[model samples]
Target: MTEEKLQDDIGVAAATEASPEEKSLREKFGDQVLSVSAGLDCEVVVLARECIAEACHYLKNTLGFEQIMDLCGVDNSALPGWSDASPRFEVVYNLLSVSKNRRLRLKVGANERDLVDSVTEVWPTANWFEREAFDMYGIIFNHHPDLRRLLTDYGFEGYPLRKDFPLTGRVEMFFDEAQWRCVYRPNQLTERVLVERTWPGVDRG
Candidate 1:
């Protein structure tokens, strides 16, 4: 057999069929799973908020998606049709199975003030990832041991990744020579209009 044929065979064997994975989720969670996107590169399963923790546990132990590769929050507030949608935040989980060379993704939604259960207990490595999501998107993870900001300063005012956050930001930092430290103050950059002229297809009237 040629090298290319061997690689093709490996690719076929490594990825699990999408149907079985979706079927397994249905067997376990029934309608709690909102949707499944199974692609050649990876598979994604979206679960109800209350089912996230339980589904994570099942995937790690039962489905053999042993590693939690990444976790991040998505702010849908500014999406064209999602402005008024409830559960304004979505957290995506990336799971990898090294033994099988397969990958999966899980997503769940959270309302503005609602908190999702923490998966740190299942995957200890999720500690920092969860904190970063909380810091950037302001999505709370319930039962998280330390839910403080991971990337931002001690008193950062707003969630920087949220679409509504000002492009220039709420504050700017500078070193105060007299005080021998840094201080943050309201942004001083003057706002400038980028587009002064109206173009075709635009309703200027």
Candidate 2:
């Protein structure tokens, strides 16, 4: 099928019941983890600012998805993670149910200015992951006991993963006590300095 046709079909499918894998999940988990997108193994996504906490709780307690295998945050400001409403940051939760022997991936998108609910209450391992997400992607985990820089040094300015953040570098300042002077330099922006050369008889006085 043509690209346009395929896109139309996908839209229609989303309007109805998500694909088979997602249909099964809806039948199983009900409204716990909404299947916003579905294809091969079921791509379930939830809005972080809206239903992240509830979804994590259900997946852990009700669904017996005890183990949070991995948690990652992705910056989707450039390309929308989902539909038009997909936000600036996405918190992806990879869960494993040891008893049920199943694996699930839940994606939660948060607006640039909004924060996702913290899952540390359900999974202690989530603490570090959430902190990392906040540190790199700037996706805050609301209600986190402590939120601060992890990889970058304390008092770091911008979110490194953000697209708009400087890729070349940042400005740095230092004091030159030897010359009794202070120096400020923009690490990313530089200009060439030139000196004038004169002949032997040029302006000797």
Candidate 3:
């Protein structure tokens, strides 16, 4: 089918009712399930950070969401309409139920100092994904066996993906002939112009 047709179908499906999985999750977790909403093509569940591991266990073993397609982090501190009371960071998990032909997204809010429970025990693939999240967004994962930098170097200074990170980056690297090794130095940008960004549909005036 065409992309537009697919999107129309998804919109209709979202409008009709909540998915069976969403109902089950709400019924099971109750207060632990913060919110249930429809995404472009899947159901999204926002869970309390404390019970995320428990919810994932139930979703995998009982609900048959057997595969975790992806796991990533988001920094919402500078997002439009973000609330000051809400956590600044979020960890998102995309799960796929092959047998049921459905997808689900799980999100847990986390503060900068809070440690999110690692899901490596539930899904082994989460090991590297969690490490990458830690490396990029500085989100800590509790009980992760080897939570280290996956993409960045050992002495990387700052989380690159955060909204507050510099556009030119924290440091510059070059091969030093005298030292016979690669060396990193502080960024030497002479000038930077801060630009205000406006969203497409939002009116600033």
Please give the TM-score that candidate 3 achieves against the real structure.
0.87
TM-scores for candidates 1 onward, in order: 0.82, 0.66, 0.87
Best by lDDT: 3
Q: What's the lDDT for residue 148 in model 1?
A: 96
Poorly placed runs, candidate 1 (over 4 Å): 1-18, 191-205
Comparing 2 and 3 by lDDT, which wins?
3
What C-alpha lDDT, on a 0 to 100 scale, does residue 66 get in candidate 2? Answer: 95
- Give the alpha carbon lDDT tens digit for every residue of 14-94 in model 1: 664556667888999999989887656777788999988888888889888789999999988765557565668899998
> After best superposition, candidate 3 residue 125: deviation in angstroms?
0.8
Q: Provide the lowest-lDDT 10-residue window in model 3.
A: 190-199
Query: Per-residue lDDT tens digits of candidate 2, residues 1-205?
Result: 8999999999887667554435544666566554475425635556435777776786688777899988888876565234546566778888888887776788876776786789999999888888888888888788998877789765567787876676654756678888786665677665443655455556856
State the C-alpha lDDT per candidate: 0.87, 0.72, 0.91
Model 2, residue pairs in steric clash: none
Sort by lDDT, best first.
Answer: 3, 1, 2
Give the true-structure RMSD of model 2. 13.7
